[model samples]
Target: MTNKKQRLASVDALRGFDMFWIIGGEALFAPLLALTGWSLFAFGHEQMQHSQWHGFRFYDLIFPLFIFLSGVTLGIANKSLQGLPLENRWPVYRKAIKRLLILIGLGIVYNHGWGSGIPADLSEIRYASVLARIGFAWFFAAMIVWHFGPRAQYAIAAAILLGYWLLQVGFGPLTPADSVNSWLDQCCLPGITYLNRPYDPEGLLSTLPSIVNALVGVFAGRWLRQKAGQHTNILVGLAAGGLACLLVGLLWHRVYPINKELWTGSFVLITSACSLLLLALFYLLVDRWQWRYFNYFFAVIGCNAILVYLGTSLVNWQYSSNSLFGGIAAALPDAAGTLVIACGVLLLQWLVLRWLYRREIFISP
Candidate 1:
C-alpha cells in the first residue's frame, strides 16, 4: 500500500512521546518523587532509570523503540520502493549510507566536545553509541527492504536473530572479562568505547541482533499497512503478537539472558513487541478515535525528531535555561530544582520546534 504523502500524525505522536521521556519526562519524574513523596509517581521515577545490567525497564525500551519506528517507516514507505529496479535503487542506498556516516560523526562529536576540537586521546571518542546503533540497524533494515518484499523481510529478520543467538551460544562459557560482545569491540574498534568500559553496550557484535529489532518494527509496519482501516483487527493482532513475543522472550531468557547490552534476540523480540503495542495505542487514540488534541505537543516534537535531539547538543539550551529558571527552582526542595530546569529546557526546545513546525522548516537527514 502506498502511504499518503501527507505525514501520519499518529506516528509523529508516538515518536514525540518517546522523545519526551529522553528530553524531559525522565527528568520530570524524579522531581515528582520529591514533590509527591512516594506515591504512584515514584514508580515512574524508578522506571525512568535503566536496569543495572540485565532485565528491562521503560528506559531500556526507548532505544529499541527508536529502531522499531525506523522499520515502521520502512513498511509504511514500502510502496515508494516497491516496484523500483535494483539499478534504479542505487541512489537511495547512497543517501542511506551518507545518513549513516553523518549519524556516526554526530555520535562521535556528541561524545567528545567540539570546543576541544575532538580529543587527541583516542580513548575519548565513543564510536559505539545510540546514534551509531540506529544507523547500523536502519542501514541493514533499509537494505532488506530494498532487496526483498515483505515476505523476504520476515525471513531475513528470523535469520538475523537466530544467527546472532547461535553466535553468542556457540562462542561458549563467557566470563565478564571474556564476553564475546566485548571482545569484538576491543578487536574491531580499538580506541573508542563507552564509559571507559571493556565492553560497550552499543558494541559492534551486539549490533547484528539490533538489526533484527528494526526488522521486527518493519514487520509491524507492514502488518499495519495490510490491515489499514481495520482498527479492531490491528489492535488485537498487535496485542496478540506483543504477548507472544513477551512470553517467548521471558522463556528464552532462561538460556540466552535478555541483556540490553548484548542486544540479545530475546531483548529484540520483547522490546519490539512493546513498541508494536504502543504504536497500536497511539493509532487507536489519535488516528482511529481522533483524540488528537492531547498529543498535539507530542506531534510538534515528532515532526523534527532528529532536529530537537541534535539541537539539545549543538545548542547548550540547558545552561541558558538553568540561568533563566534555575534560581526559582532552586528555592524549591530536593531534585525539584533539576526538574524545573528540565521543564524550562523542554519548553524552550518545544517552542523552537513549534516555531519551525509553523514555518514547515523540518530538518530531515
Candidate 2:
C-alpha cells in the first residue's frame, strides 16, 4: 500500500484500539479478580472504571483519545482538499455540519437510547455527552483550520489553553456544589447535564479547552501526512513532543489541576500528549515497520467505529453473549474464566465490524 494509505490505516488502528476499550474489551479483566480471588486482579479491574471526580485513569483517556483522533482525521481530510477551489470546499463545511447534527442526535440517543424511550421534559436532557463533545470540538477545530489555516490553528489552541487557565485562576477556589465551572454551566442551561450532577464533566464551559486537544491533533496529523517520508525525524519529534507536553501538564497541574471533569488545560496537555505518543506507537507498527497484519483487528473495528459503537449501545450484546458463551466461561476452573463472557461480547462486536470491513462498509462521521 502507499505511505499515505498506511498513515490513514494507522489512524484507524489507533481509533479501533481506543474503541476496543469502550466496547467492553477492558471489561475482560474485571471478572478475573472474583475468579482467582486475587487483589492484584481486583486492582486491575478497578482501573476499568472512571475516576470519580479528580485524577485520571485508562477509561478517562478514551474520549480525549478519540477526540484527538477526530482532529487528526480532520487535518488529514483538510490537507487532501487543499487543491480544490474555495467554492468547491463548501461541501466540506456542509458535510461537517450534517455530521455534527448526526452526532448530536446519536449522543442524545446513546444517553437516552434505552428501552424506556425519550423523556418528555426538556429537563430530562443530558446536554453533555461523548458524541456531542466530539462533534463540537471537531467542528470548531476544522473551521479554525479551514478559515485561518494551520498557523492560526496553533495560535487558537495555545490561546484556549492559556485562557482556560486564566479563567480558573480568576474564579479562584470553589467547592463542588459551588464550583465555578458547574455553576456557570447550570446558570446557562437549567436542567441539562451529565448524570444529573451539578457539573457535567462534558459540560459547555469545559469543552473550550477540549478543542485544544483536537487542534493539537490537527498538527500531529499534519506531521504524519507531510513528513511520513522522513520517518526518523517524525518519530523522534513525536516522542519528544509527547514528553514535553507531559512535563508541561505535570508542572501546570500545580496551579490548574489536571482534572478530566474540568478538561483543565493541564488535563488537555497530558491527554493530548498521551494520544500523540500512542498514535506514534501505532504508526510505528503499522506505517514505519509495515506490520500490517498486527493491526488488522484494530483496523476492522476502526473502519466501522461509529457503527459498532451504536451496536454496542442499541443491542443487549452482553446478555446475548452470556447466553451463548456463559457456558464456556462457567466451564473454566479459574476465576479468569468469567472473562470469557466479556471476551465473547467483544468477539461479537468484532464479528459485526469484520463483516462490514469485508464489504468495505465504513460508517464514519
Candidate 3:
C-alpha cells in the first residue's frame, strides 16, 4: 500500500477543486467572458448557475460532490475500523456524532444568517441546510460502512436508490410544490423554507437519496484503498465505474428525471458519476503523477474547507478583499475590474486557509 498520509492529499485537492468553484471560481468566469469574449468562459459561466426546477448543471453538483467526498474520506479512514472490536469503535462513533451535531447546528446557523443575527422567532429558522444534509448522509453512511461488508454495502445502496424512486412515484409528482419531498418539508420541517417555499432543496426526504450519493463515494474510496499503488488498475476501475454510472444515470433519467432539487435517484447517480470521474482525474494527476506544485493551491483550501465555507458566510471576506484590492480593481476596465475583485476575494480566503495549512490546523465538521 502507498504511504497512508499520501493517499489523502489527492482527495483533499479534489475537495478544494470543488469548493474553489463554489467560493469564487465561478464568479471569475463572467469577467473572463466579458474581457476575452470567449465562448469557453461563456459556457463556464452558464454551467456555474444552478438549473431551475429540473435537469442538471455543473453548479448543482457542488453540494452533493462535497457530501460524496465526505464519504470517500469516511471509507478510507474507516478501513481499519472494520478490523477493530465493536466496543473499540465507540470513540470513533463519538467523534462522528460530534461532527454530525456540529454540522447540523452550523447548517441551521448557515441558513438562519451568520453575520445578520438570528431572527427573533425560532420558527423563522430553516433547519434543513447543505451542511445538515452532509452531516446526516455522512453519519448514516459511516454507520453502514462500519457495520457492513462491501457486498452488503453495495446491496444497501441499490436498495436506497430504487426505494427512493418508488417512494417518489407512490407519494407525489415531481413538481416543486407537489412532490413528496416538498410535502415533507412543508409539513414536518420547521422554520423558514428557502429556495422553494414549502420546500427546501436540502430538505427532509431528499436526504435519503443523498445518503446513496455518499455511499457511492464510499464505494469508490474502498476501491481506491484496496487497489493502492496499482495506478493503472485504479485508473481503469474508476473510469469504468464512472462511465457505467453515467450510463445508468442517463437511462434512469428517462423515467425518473435527473432533478437536483429533489435529490432524485437519477440525480444521485449522475452526480456520483461526475464525482467519480473528477476524483479519478485528481487521483491520476495529483497522486499518480505527483503533481504537488499545482495541487498545493487546492490542497490548502481543502485542508481548511469547513473553516472557509463557514467563514465566507459568517465573515465578510469580500469587504476585506475590497479594502485591499478595490483600488487596483477599479483602475482596470469593467470586465477586468470584476475579475480582479473576484480574484482578490478568492486570494483573501486562500490566504487564511494557507495560514492554517502552514500551522497544520485543518478543521472539519
Candidate 4:
C-alpha cells in the first residue's frame, strides 16, 4: 500500500451528524413541531427517543453509529501508522489503554458523581456504559486492525457476531420461563434485576455484539482506502452493507429481537446498516460535491465529541439557561426559553471547540 493518506470529509461530516442528535434532540427540533400542532412530527420525535425495551428506534442508533464511526477513524489511524518502528507502537498502545480507562472513569463518575442515593453497602457501581463500551471496542478493534491485516480483521468480526449469537442461544443462562429467546434479557446479563431496576444499559454480555458495530466500520475504512475508483467503490459497498444489515436485522429480530438495552445481534446489524447508509450519504454530499458549509457546525462538535458529552453530563444546562440567558428568553414564550437554552448550549460548546481548535488542542476518549 502507498504511504499517502486520504482525508475523507464524509467521515468527519458523519461524526458531526451523529453528534447533533447527542447534543440536543428535544431542544433543537421538538419545540417547533409543538408550535405547528403537527402531531406526526411530534410523534416522530417521541419515537426518536429511545424505546423502553424489545424494539428498535431512531434514537437508539446514535451510540452504535458513533462507535462505528470510531472504528472507521481507527482504520485511518492505523493506516497512517504504517511502517513505524516497534518502539513507536508502544506509545500508541499506551494512549489507547489510557483512553479506555478514562472512559470507564467518566462513566462511573457520571453515574455516581453526586453520590448514589442507594447505600454504599448496596451500591454496585456499574462498570459498563456506552462510553466505556465504545472505549473498549475502539481500543480492541484498532489493535486488531493494526496487528492483523484487514482480511483477518474481517474474519475476526464475523467470528464475534456469529459466535455471540450461538453463545447466547446455547450456553446463556435459562430464564425461569425456560424460553431460549428470553436468555439474553433475563439471564445472560450481569446485574441486580428486580421489579423496579432491571438490566444495566451497558452490561457485560451485550458488549460482544457491540464490538461488531465497530468492526463493520473498520471494513468500511479499508474499502475507502482502496486505490482503484474510490468513490464508486465506497458508495456501492455502503449501500450493499446497509441493505444487507437491515434485512439480516429484521430476520434476526424474529428470534433475538432488536433490544438496545441488551445490544442484541439484530440491533447491532440494523444500526450498523443505518450507519453505513448515513455514511454513504454524507460521503456523496461532502466529499463528492464539496458541500462544506453546514459541515463546519457539526465538525466543531465532532472534533470535541467527548468534551461536549462530558459538558452536558457535568454542567446543568437548565440552570445555566435560567441564570445566564433567562432575561432574553423571558420576553419570548415558554417553549422559546427552552429553545434559546438549547441553542446556547450548542453555541457554548461550539465556542469552546473553536478555541481548542485554534489552540491546536484535542481531547480523545
Candidate 5:
C-alpha cells in the first residue's frame, strides 16, 4: 500500500522483464533456440507462441501474467490512495478513467490508422487487442477494488473464472477440431472472431478471464502493502498463490483444457501462478539482493512500455537497423530479417526508454 514514491523496485523490474518479451521476441530466449536450427513454428516454439485451438504453452502465460501484475500494482496504488481524503478520491478515479481511455485509444490507433493508405473497411480493423483487453480489465478491476474491499474483489475474480469455466463446459456448443470451448469462442465472438491474416491476440470473450487475472494481482498487491517485512510477505504470498494456481490449473486442464485463445480457467490459474512465481523471483534477486545493473535496463523499458509498443508499430525500425548494423549482419550471410528487425526494435525501444527515464518522464497506464 505504499505510495508511488515508495513503490517497490521489484515491481518495476518485473514490469520491465515482461515488456522485454513484448517489445521484441529476440530479447527473449526464444530467438536463441530458433537460431540453433530450431524452428519457432516447429515443436515447442509454435506452442510457445500460441495454441492453435486448444492446449497450453509457455508463451500463453505471458499476457495473463502481465495483467495479474497490473492487478497487484492496482492494489498497491489503492493503498497509497488511503492517505488522501474522501474529496481526493474523485480526482484519482478520474485519472484512472483517463489512463484506461488513453490505453484503449492507443490500442485502436495501433490497429487502425488516421493516415493515408489506411484500410477502408472498418470491420477489418482489429477491434479487440492486448491493450484494449488490459485497459478494460484494469478499469473494471480497479473500480471493484475501489468500491468493495480486497476480499470482495478476490471473491468477484474467483466467481468470474469459475463462472466462465462452467459456462464453457456446461452450455457451450462443440467444435469438430477441438472441444466445445473452441467452438464457444467462435459462437460468442462471431463477427469479431480472429479469422487469420491480422488477428486479435486479445479478443472479446477472452477478456473475461483476463479481468480475473488482473484482480488476482489486485489481491496480491493489497496483501503485499500490509505492514510487514516486504521480502518475507512477498515470498510467502507468491509461493502459496503460485502453487495453488499450478495445482488448480493442472487439475482443471483435464476437463477444460488450458487453452490460451479460449482463456480457460486452467490457463488463468497456471499463468497467475507463473506470474506470482516470477514476481517472487524478481523481488528476491533485484530487491532483496540489491542487484542494480540488470534492473536499470528493464526499468527504462518498463517505464515507457506503451510508448515503445506504439512507436514500434507506427514507425518502422528497419531503416534504423540498416543504417546501424545492417552491413555487419549482411557480411555474416543468411541472417534472417526477423532477427535483424527484432534487434533493431529492442535497441530503439531501449534508447527511447533510457532517454525518457533520464528526463524523469514516465508514460504509465
Candidate 6:
C-alpha cells in the first residue's frame, strides 16, 4: 500500500538537536560548567566528551544516533515509493547512491585532504571518517530497505550484529592493536590515517555493526508512519522496545563489553535504546502533544542539517563569531568571554540555517 510523506516535526527537530551538539551546542554549553561551577553542568560536560577506549557516553551516541535518524527518515521518505514498480524506484536508488558518494567525498574534505596540498602519498589521507561511516551505513541500510520486506530487513540487522560479534570474538581480543577490526583496517585500508594509530574508530569491520543502528531507525520510522490515532500505543511500544534493547545490551555487555570505539554489538543495542527513547520523548512532546514552542530553534537547524554541517566545515564561523562579538567578549571576564564567543558562534551558525530554512532551501544527502 502507498503512503503519503508524513511530515514529522519531531524527526527534524531531533536531527537538529543531534546536529546542535556537533556544530556548537557542546562548545556553547560545556563552558557553563566552568562559569557556574554547577554539578549538573559538570556532569553534562563529562558526557560531552568521548570515552577514551571503551565504554559508552552521550557524545558517543551522537554519530550512531544521526545514522539511526537517517534510517528513520528513509522509512518516512520511502512511504511514498512503497508500492511503486521496481523500475520506478531506480530514481531514488540513484539519489541514495549519489548522496553516499557526495558524503564520502565530503568526508574526505572534512578530514582536510589535499586542501592544503596533495600529500606526496595517497596514504596520508584519512579514508575512514565520521561522515564516511554515516554515509556507508546509511547507503547499505537504504539498499536493504529498498529491496527487502520488513521481516528480511530485521533478519539482516540481526545477522549483521551477530556475525560481527562472532568475528570479533573468534578473530582476536578487543584490543586496539590486536582486535580483528584493527587488523582488517590495517590490511584493507592501508595508509589511511588511523584516528587511533593502527585502529580507526570508523574502521571497516566496525561499520558492519553500525548498519544495524540505521536499521533500528528504519524500524522506528516505519512504526511512526503507521496510521494516525494510535499515538499512545506507539509511545508505549517505543518505550518498551527501547527498554528491552537496553536490557539485552546490558546483558551482552557482560560478554562483549560496551565499547563505542569498537562499535561493539552491546554498544549498538545500548545506543539504539537511547535513540528510541529519545525519539519517543520527542514524538510525544512535539508531534503528539504539540509542545513545539521550544522545538522551533532546533527545527530550523534540522531543516538544513547537512547544509549547516558542511557550512561549519567550509565557512570560518569562528572568525565571523569573533568579528561580530569580539568587542563584547573582550569586555567580559575570561570565562564569560569564552561563553559569549561560543554563543555567538552558535548563533551565527543557527542564523545561516534559519535563513535557509526560511527560504525553504533544505539540503539533504
Q: Give the winner by lDDT.
A: 3
Which is the better candidate, 2 or 3, if ranked by TM-score?
A: 3
For residues 162-232, could you state the per-residue lDDT of candidate 5 as single tens digits?
88887777754423334444454455543353444222347665677888888888877766776235678
Clashing pairs in 2: 35-335
Best by TM-score: 3
lDDT of 4 at 159: 87
Model 5 RMSD in Å is 4.1
lDDT tens readout by residue for model 1, 157-208: 8888888888888886544446788778888875566766778888888889
C-alpha RMSD for every candidate: 2.6, 2.5, 2.1, 4.1, 4.1, 2.6
Stretches > 4 Å off in candidate 6: 1-7, 78-89
Question: Candidate 1 — which residues are off by over 4 angstroms?
Answer: 1-7, 79-86, 113-124, 334-338
Better of 1 and 6 by TM-score: 6
**Each prediction's whole-model lDDT (CA):** 0.79, 0.82, 0.86, 0.73, 0.71, 0.84
TM-score, cand. 5: 0.84
Model 3 steric clash total: 0
Which runs of model 3 end up more than 4 angstroms from their true locations?
A: 80-87, 113-119
> Against the hidden reference, what TM-scores do the models get?
0.91, 0.92, 0.95, 0.85, 0.84, 0.93
Residue-pair clashes per candidate, as listed? 0, 1, 0, 0, 4, 0
- Give the TM-score ranking, best first: 3, 6, 2, 1, 4, 5
Predicted candidate 4 versus true structure: per-residue lDDT over 1-365, tens digit per residue: 13222234567667877877776655666766756768877876786678777787788988999899998876655554557897988898888899899998887665553234554433344555668888888878877787787678779888888887787667654232333334443555433332224445666666677888999888777667663247777789889989998998999889877878767788899999999899888877766666777666667677777777777778776676567788888888877766787777666667777788667686876
Candidate 2 lDDT over residue span 158-196, tens digit each: 988898888876886644566678778888854467666
Q: Whose TM-score is higher: candidate 4's or candidate 5's? A: 4
Better of 1 and 2 by lDDT: 2
